[model samples]
Target: MEAKKVALVMVDISGYTHFIRAQKVSAIHAEEIVFELLEAVIDRAEYPLTLNKLEGDAVFLYAEIGDNNLARVTRDVAKQVQGFFEAFYDRARTLTEERAECGCDACSRVHDLRLKVLLHSGEAVFRQIRQFEELAGEDVIAIHRLLKNDIPAREYILMTDAFHNLAGNLAGMAYTPSQQTYPDLGTLQIHVFQPSN
Candidate 1:
């Protein structure tokens, strides 16, 4: 089968469960608020958003914003991700500094979510099964590892080499070393944004 171009992204928050664990209110309520905030962020972006499976504090997302030239498709995906991270960070920061303008769900839970965005692009088999987006094989697996190994808890965006190579704005952005293990591939290297800690 011929391979299709796709980017597999994984978004998750740091200190999410810990925040709920220490909360006086119900954990479900706290989690629900975070989930709602995440949903709104994705919805506002208008990027193809699909939730596959939730992994603890993490949320799996598959975004396909229509197809364009393969190169442009990948770069745009990175830009879209970068933009989303900035927007989310701004929202969270405003809430933290007590400058939040809205009293909505996002503002309320803004302090609870610190998002880590990971992007990995490669060839894949994309099949729309009913209301689901199912992508399988090494491409999918590779992207998952890219997200897992590259993105740190506090860092905003981590892009695999394939993604960085195609992303338009690389020269100005900082890059840091990222190494990880894959099922059969053993050790691999990628790039991650340096946390300005």
Candidate 2:
């Protein structure tokens, strides 16, 4: 492994903390549901994605050595990520509708369920070290910046240009625009979160 060819993932569920603070059951329910959905995707996919852990209503993940490269765009990675978000988002939408029908007091306040997915290509792997994951470089930093400073307020599946560049010749991907400006951080693009119909 010259450099760990991985897709650094940082996905978050909106209103996670607020739900946790207001109701334990809702928070727990939210976590379980989200985790289950994520876990299923990771499990079913043949790509190199893994479940790092479930933190609050957020799931930290990473996809390892798939079709990511710097030749063209992340045709494979983008499609997989977009598909995952759409699937989960669709399910999340169903969950929201169900809550209204169930009239569950705890879940009533959850007006929306959205995810922010950040995928980065970098060098390093964290495998049962019981120690830590090394991400001390520009690649990791750029990803953080994309998620924190670049992505829109309410968007889903925003990927770094680094990932897209690796798509190689594959085409047909619709991503949103990035609000933050980071010209030095390679090609940064944000897919304006849309659930697949």
Candidate 3:
């Protein structure tokens, strides 16, 4: 098997666990809200990027680094990231407002949802089983490890140092340094970019 250069991304809904617990919403209604938002983000995905899997409240996506122009690839990934958030927040606002008069807890509190993205670029091995395509390698682990961090902002995008080196400048986005240690991955340095309202 050959290693392929790819950009890995994870879009996760923040405040989901806390929101469901605090609102005391029923499982059926809670799932409905979650699935709807997840679908909205999935629907906004563009070419070169494909949805790998849905891990509960997060959607994992991957795209091969086909373009030699590193800057273009980074910018495109940033654009897709921005598009997902736009769709997510817009749909959330609409749903919350639409159900404002409703008595259901899930419907009324839908506005509490937020989104965060974790991105990294590295070599990964693609594996296929049955009808599904999956990515496996250190890069996959690196992106998932990013999900747990001490970043104060609930809604922000975090990129690994490798990704930052290639796409950070092209993104025209500002980020702050974040460092965290994982048992297996050692001390990982990341860049945090908080999206503006």
List model 1 lDDT by residue over 1-197, tens digit each: 33566667777676676677665554555665566556545654544445655666566665543346656666666666666666666656654556355444434555666777777776667667787656777757876666545343566577777666666444456777677777786776567774332
Clash totals, every prediction: 0, 12, 0
Best by lDDT: 3
lDDT of 2 at 147: 55
Q: Which of 1 and 3 is ahead in lDDT?
A: 3
Error of 3 at 86 (Å): 1.2
lDDT per residue as tens, model 2, 1-197:
13556666766666556555666656666555556556644654445456665555555666666443433223555566656666665666666777666554445654455556666676554444455554445666676676556343565566555564564322344556454467676555543444433
Q: Name the top TM-score candidate.
A: 3
The alpha-carbon deviation from the true structure for residue 144 of candidate 1, after best TM-score superposition, in angstroms, is 2.5
lDDT measured at residue 2 in model 3 versus the true structure, 0 to 100:
65
Kindly report which residue stretches of model 1 are placed more than 4 angstroms away from their true locations once superposed.
Answer: 1-3, 47-59, 62-68, 90-112, 128-130, 150-153, 168-172, 195-197
What C-alpha lDDT do the candidate models reach, one value each? 0.62, 0.56, 0.84
All candidates: CA RMSD (Å):
4.7, 4.6, 1.8
Give me the overall lDDT of model 2. Answer: 0.56
Give the lDDT ranking, best first. Answer: 3, 1, 2
After the best TM-score superposition of candidate 2, give how far the Cα of residue 136 lies from its true spot, in angstroms. 5.7
Specify the poorest-scoring 10-residue window by lDDT in model 2: 66-75
